[model samples]
Target: MRDRSTGHPRNAWYALAASAEVGSTPLGTRALGTPVVLYRAGDGSVVALGDRDAHRPYPLSLGHVDGDTIVSGYSGFAYDRTGACVRVPSQAQVPYGARVPSYPVVEEGDLVWVWLGEPSLAALRPPVSTPWLTDAGWDTFGGAWETAAGIGLLHDNFADITHVAVVDPVISPPALTGVAPALEVELTETTVHFHRDWPAAPLPEWQAKISGASTTASYPQREEGAFLAPGLWADRWDVFIPADEGGTQTFRFTHAVTPVDDHRTRHLWRVSRNFAPGAEASDVLRPIFESYYLKVREILETMQQVIDRDGYGEDVNVAADLAALQVRKILRRLVADEG
Candidate 1:
């Protein structure tokens, strides 16, 4: 586990918001405990800057956007895309040292990523690729949540799946309860992967309805995923239910976690499926996915409350925690290296 006092690592790219969510309006958000404002320039490119006005320390997101600049609502101080104070309404000359800090931003794969560290190091590492979110052959649906838990807990939740049977019985197979599947783990310098192949089991009602398979039918399932980086995790499911053409159905799940502060986190999730590839399919699955994540959020938030009231104790690990422990180890190393 990470030392709570060390705080979040600054030398990494975190997802600020979904591409579709950021537009002409200035968005106010917090990352790594610093307030940030995000908006699009004239060419539809993202710009991230310190959210506070340099003159009066007011929130810049409350201001309105000019053609390519953001004008402060409190004092009419206008700042350009570079975060330079280009215009002052009350005076002719723009005061020296009247500019806000600007951060590097990248828009890729339907997400806007921002670098919150030294400007020089932003070029050394880029955010992980998630091409499937925009691929033509797949349909995707997702939503964001303001979680009360820490980022580490969210990563741990994704790394271990045994909790699914207890927390989300509607989607998990009954056989998973009290039964551990053989897990294969692969580790890299910055990533950890886990794979598990479960024997033939009856399909849960929710999954059977989506896959067009009978609830009584049994199928082999393959679960695999990787911790791509501190900010992203990607996983997939391959259910060997016979398709009309004798193939299997695939579901891809991706999570982007960003820390808002020591006790709060931002979680963004995306679910993509190759079987359904249209707007109608996305509409049908959006609410179902939302419900699924809402339950997860409730449970995680409750855990956070308990941990806060009574301090965290020594952790005991079992066979099911192998991948989750690896996630914590890798994160601790990254945080230390940054320090």
Candidate 2:
């Protein structure tokens, strides 16, 4: 995503995932690690802002059609599209106005762009990664795992698959024995291709040992370290880009983490498909898939316990760590450059 004014991504990297009906609203989210408030305009535009105090219920966008004045929030504050307070609630036909801050925002493509930083610095926030989500039949399944390290460590963990030998009971990647074929890396301004789908057997042993997927042709195409490759990214890693009509799709599976603070975190995820809500998993796994969800959560819950009780430090490194390290460095540069 690019800043409408400065044409920079450092300003914002996520778009609103909501539609613009006068009553339509979306739960706020953190994009590029920045907490934000998102709202849609009735005419099909999204506005994102830096402030995210849901209690205040201050709206960042209100779907204004006049090309100006935006009805901000339940508390009542009307502002221009650029975030300038155009009308005060207290001064409305009746009194009882509210006071708050607002910032300029714009909607383009399928993403919402907000200028949270100083308009002057918006030009410096360069793009770091590209996204690869879709509006197609994409199903997403995610979970949060505690690492023996920090966010940086988590990145290293996903880049490789050696530790599964010790943590997993079944699913195993033969190449993980330090003998697997080298992973291929393709890098470009708006894309990164790590196209190595090392083979995997559909055996119980292989399935049990899996916690994350690293080998794949598919990857996210976010403007940052844009990782996108067509075809099945790998045997265990399939990122089904969601479709527009909210049609059915599936997210193979993987892990992600959200920081609670320096030492704490919150983790939540879901597996969705374009199929009608009543549809079942394909015939092969349908019989057993429902049970796996519980089992998977149970195992991951235990994993987090270890981290909470024991805390963690790191020592060893693996090949998978490389891509993750690169991604981190690239992100740091974007943040620093923006500053």
Candidate 3:
């Protein structure tokens, strides 16, 4: 955890989870620099929010689970799921009858999202839902990576598919030996067109021996990298985003540096798919395919290890990588301008 101002602690909380396990609707507890408790209520809702500021009462979740009563958290007193006080676990009297804060909790696409709009505002806002592999008929897999430097380097790598030869050779074989990749940009609000193609008649085995992909038919160039290939991927649609909040809705962070505050910029994400499993065009795998997307993460982490050691720039360049570089610049401009 290197420190950066703009809500690092807050962003870190999500990032840690992004890299952690949520179980198969299971119950488990892990410290997120806090006494965070996660439980699948009898009502089938996954709750994740600020646990009661301990020093008060027990986590509302640990309280008995009744029909509508959710033991969310504790103040100097105890409250149920609905933020209603049902017991006095600490002092004889519930302090001032005040209630612990509650986050909007909901489960979708196999993951639980906790609204973060403060203890009060979260309740007023509707929760966002996103597609996941846990849903029926879809398969998803991905891995993580930290480029030679900050977010900009990653933007280049994910946006440009021309570097398959060097990054994860196991996936991209016959290494994309090119002088430069073609560049085309679109400045519309709808979509930023940054496209690249792989060699004709690419071989997975040959590429497999080299990188994470045999060929880069197309890759999602957003906060996170989503590659679309015939095999070893969740879907044909390459959806990519940099960051996400409340598990259900992720920012398909395309571009770089979005501001959460003046000192810090938040990573963004764009979810290309729908949270509704019924909306998937392919056969549903739910858990199976959902499990597959996790693999993409594995491959990416491996590549990051290599990139970190070697670094982000090359004296020799690929035209495709040039476009990738430009995309990073665009992203940086958005972040700066938005600020």
Number of the predicted model whose lDDT against the real structure is largest: 1
Q: Local distance difference test, per candidate?
A: 0.85, 0.38, 0.36
Comparing 1 and 3 on lDDT, the stronger one? 1
Off by over 4 Å in 1: 1-6, 242-246
Tens digit of per-residue lDDT, candidate 3, span 1-339: 332211211211122123134422323232212434454445545555345533454554444334434443334343455554555555676556565444455453433444433455444533333444344433333333222233333333455554455544544324255433345554442124554433233333532222233244332322123221100011122223123411221223221222222222222221233322233321332333334323433455455555556544444655555545554444445334435
Q: Tens digit of lDDT per residue, candidate 1, span 100-207?
A: 999999898998999998889988898899999999877888989899988877888899878887776776765475467878999997899999988888766765
Could you tell me which residue pairs clash in candidate 1?
none
The estimated TM-scores of all candidates read 0.94, 0.51, 0.48
lDDT of 1 at 24: 91
By TM-score: ranked, best first? 1, 2, 3
lDDT of 2 by residue, 39-115 (tens): 55455455444433223544344323234344545644554434445565565553234323344454332223345
Q: Which candidate's TM-score is highest?
A: 1
Looking at candidate 1, what is the lDDT of residue 232? 89
Worst ten-residue run, lDDT, model 3? 227-236
**Distance from true position, residue 203, model 1, in Å?**
2.4
